[model samples]
Target: MAASVEHDSLESMEAPQTAVEVEETKTFKDLGVTDVLCEACDQLGWTKPTKIQIEAIPLALQGRDIIGLAETGSGKTGAFALPILNALLETPQRLFALVLTPTRELAFQISEQFEALGSSIGVQCAVIVGGIDSMSQSLALAKKPHIVIATPGRLIDHLENTKGFNLRALKYLVMDEADRILNMDFETEVDKILKVIPRDRKTFLFSATMTKKVQKLQRAALKNPVKCAVSSKYQTVEKLQQYYLFIPSKFKDTYLVYILNELAGNSFMIFCSTCNNTQRTALLLRNLGFTAIPLHGQMSQSKRLGSLNKFKAKARSILLATDVASRGLDIPHVDVVVNFDIPTHSKDYIHRVGRTARAGRSGKAITFVTQYDVELFQRIEHLIGKKLPVFPTQDDEVMMLTERVTEAQRFARMELREHGEKKKRSREDVGDNDDTEGAIGVRNKVAGGKMKKRKGR
Candidate 1:
């Protein structure tokens, strides 16, 4: 925590007017955003710059290797996307811009953002993920898209197996959610992927957490990068109605459904800790009759893509996914975000909540808290240095379930202790219910006449 605070302090001191809070009298046109970009923004109903875009867009356009410390939904995608797209257009080369994400979902999301933003500029964006055809990816590569968004594993496979696909002329190497990609067990794959990219290319790394691993990767991959710390709270939007819950683990799932049903939000996302758990909860939600989508790494890439597309396109509202779904996911219409599983890392909480309260829309983050999750939330609050608001609700079923689970465990332990008190009446009694052979190295008389060695062996 101290190290993170020190880093933030240093970065804050270095940055002047970091975010665009006030209305800019000068248009994006004056800030170097092209006419096509403006037209596209207007078409998409994007009138003003997000705090992240305001700070990052200008810096990236200057051909700098920028290091952004931010979570998902901070508009970092457009921050880099708009500038890099324009930069590429200016050079007008048959080259590609590389974006590396932690998961296939994020890769697709960023690809969509690029295609949406740059399509008006006649810019091309292609996505490369596993479970999709390499032939298709190869064909897309043959088209020579200006930008390529891909997961590390799939990109490595393409580099190794697919012929005539190279990043030799790659201009931009953007690493989204660098903390997850650089911190998780995928470090070896990341090292391999980094080795494949040329040193001459520009690299941009974004993450919520700045662990030592992220620092090491920065030193190794990025060249004296310009670091900016856009804290999670800033990106989450102050307008967001933040709240917390305190209950036992047994009731969290039930309580979540209770509150969500009570609110009846238009759209929502539930961040899960694991894929299997996410699946179960999504199923439970459906049994209760809610429109839910399960997204995780274990799912087929096509399914993951389909689910994300549906969620983003507003086909079905509720989304269930892990941190794997958190990075660079563009869902502009999400009005609510539920923390079904508390984030083990503090930064994840910020990212999870950031999913909502985007595009200047008011939103809410309802965290289903349990005693098990309390510590995690405490750490998160400490990271942000504040407590969250607890939303008022009338749900006591959670308390009943918690009481039942607690009572069951208490009785089970008492039974085990009471069972030990009933002493053995004879030597035979001890062996009566024993799974193991009676006594070590003991002899037993088998029938009335024969003596046998006890098979403790």
Candidate 2:
């Protein structure tokens, strides 16, 4: 009955306690973090605890199971990482903790944070996710790292097939983005994992929202969990300046170019709805000398990492991506986010815009709402509880770019078709060029060199 009541209240979207109540004067030491870990936090430049960290860490240190409700980029990683590290320090063990995330990229990112925070103590972590050879991952698991971070699907593959490996003594279990994990249809895998791991272990479930699925998972996974919700409602950050541009669907590329030109020197992350559009738009932007790149599920794992590294390193100014990049992976220098294609799910808008305006930094999000997307746009507005103003763009300025954009579009489509045909012609071409990297490589050989010289134009 208590579980049912808790579900009802969370379903109603009431935050148990607002994060604003957390005292700003509180530091990592105040949250009961160990001295070494506290110093590690300082070295990483995290001088103070974020609200989620402040609320969740103390209870976690007291050995309470936690259901942390916070928005994306709210330092959810630290809230759980500190306590897990604290426990690890007290009781040293191999295969100490397991972190499950929705995407492979997020798995690597969490591993980085755990290593950074636990570095002084020489903590070892292995990232187990798909798109990499299982043999390598098997060897990684064989070493029995202190922590193993993985996505649900690949982790299951290892559990069933890998020899001489098991989490029989696992101490901590963390589902970083619980809502997205379930949403990706990993319910069965999660259930299997839950059955294998010891229930006596500490568990932390963190998510951006409390949906019915998450409520069910919470009942199944957590035991008398303390709910620490930082943001009670669905909303964007205060520092984000959000606007919308209503234009014909055909003219999206033109307007995108105009905005990129207008906001020159600013880093941009443009979200597309499909993998094809993401690749095509990236090619178009690259052709126009915008230093564009693409990150999506179709690319090989290595290429995906390369694209992300280039974007993060500022080697590339524009990253065209599918919804896969929208959730938990943080690239801190983004100045603008363009929803080149509006998201079908209204809730995704929050996560997409969240790519920017992170860590107290100001940023901009401009969504392109075509006539077909009006209903979806309205739903997003209604969800966020505010109507977005139209972004200022001169029609003539946008129209002037149509000729060049059209040529780029034609070249992009041709490149995609030619690449697809090349893949069919040779079986050896299967692995590397199977996604965006090969297409980009082909562009370099075919026309990117010529386009590179015209970048400043």
Q: Score every model by TM-score.
A: 0.77, 0.91
How much is the lDDT of residue 47 in candidate 2? Answer: 87
Tell me, by TM-score, which candidate is best: 2
Cα-based RMSD of candidate 1:
14.6
Tens digit of lDDT per residue, candidate 2, span 1-457?
8666765564355343433336444688877898999999999999888888887898899887899998878899999999999999999999999999998889889999999999889999999887778899999999999999988888888899999889989989999889999888889999999999998899999999999999999999998888888875898899999999999999989999999999999999999998788888888887787788988877767778888999999998899898888889888889999999999999999999999988789999999999899999999999999989999988997899999999999988987776566645544554433221123322222223334455646
**Could you tell me how far off, in angstroms, the CA of residue 404 lies in candidate 2 after the best superposition?**
1.0
Error of 1 at 360 (Å): 3.4
Q: Model 1, residue 70: what's the lDDT?
A: 70
What are the runs in model 2 whose C-alpha is more than 4 Å off? 1-21, 426-457
Error of 1 at 45 (Å): 2.9
Give the residue spans of candidate 1 off by over 4 A. 1-16, 19-25, 232-236, 395-457
Candidates' C-alpha lDDT: 0.70, 0.86
